[model samples]
Target: MQTPATPKFTTREFRDVLGNFATGIAVVTSRDTEGRPVGCTINSFASVSLDPPLVSFCIDRQAGTFAAFQSHGHFALHFLAEHQEEVSRRFAKAGEDKFGAVEPVAGIGNVPLLSDCLAHLECSVYQRIDAGDHVLILGRVEAFSSRKDLPPLLYFRGRYARVASE
Candidate 1:
């Protein structure tokens, strides 16, 4: 079968449409050559396969952490809780020192893992694909953890949102 052409949605429209879907917030963390922390806020995290335990997330082409993540070969994903919204926003900024206030310890190959996150996944770079203005990073999970008592931070309608009670 022939594939259909790409849809002609404007950038803003595409963003708005995607924002309608609620997603959990996460921080993708790595370390530099000097072992300094490097990370960025990302909401594009998702699991891909279960048998081999694979996951993926997207990073903007211009993000400062891009180089580190691309070369470091390992990283960690921290699923944020509702109380960690500030941590999310701090890392979202392009060049800010987001980790100055938070103390994160090393995990799997010294990837920085923040404390008190809803969940943590330590992964090694499995694949990297360049797509338009972003790069899709596929990671093979080697270690993981979760805190069942915390509520997750969510993103919807282009802003951070709280999970509602049942």
Candidate 2:
């Protein structure tokens, strides 16, 4: 087999290219060992399977909430509504109280569930895959809720965006 040539683009270049594809914003929340709510914003979430009801998201290894997610083994993924850009920005920051302003309800495994999202998925960690600079967390959906009437919060080109209504 012939070896493939290395890409000429830098990491920033690749990431900029990837920004062309729009994605929904989600806040993944879980409790630390002390039972305190911990969460972070993610745009890389996707449904993996239907029969088993699996969803997956990538967490940066260096994130503040990475340890909580690795140890807790359960979490709630909240798909933010179009008006929740501040919610997304809040969780995206590091080393601050993420749940201080937001109200949280206890979920399965005591994961923190954020209110007013377009959708919510309560899940248990099904598998963890080690990927470059990040860990892929595969979760088995235990419970879920959604509101089809709400438009989704989207991220595109490193900025929050909204979908056009017909």
Tens-digit lDDT string for candidate 1 (61-121): 8888888888898999999999998999999998888889788888999998899999999
Model 2 lDDT tens row, 82-162: 999999999999998988877799999999899889999999999999998999999999999999988999999999899
Reference-based TM-score of each model? 0.93, 0.95
Q: Residue-pair clashes per candidate, as listed?
A: 0, 0
Tell me how candidate 1 scores on lDDT: 0.93
Return the clash pairs for model 1, or none. none
The most accurate candidate by lDDT is: 2
Please report, as a residue range, the 10-residue window in candidate 2 with the lowest summed lDDT.
96-105
- C-alpha RMSD by candidate, in order: 2.1, 1.6
Which portions of model 1 show Cα errors greater than 4 Å?
Answer: 1-7
Q: Where in model 2 is the C-alpha error above 4 Å?
A: 1-6
Candidate 1 worst ten-residue window by lDDT: 61-70
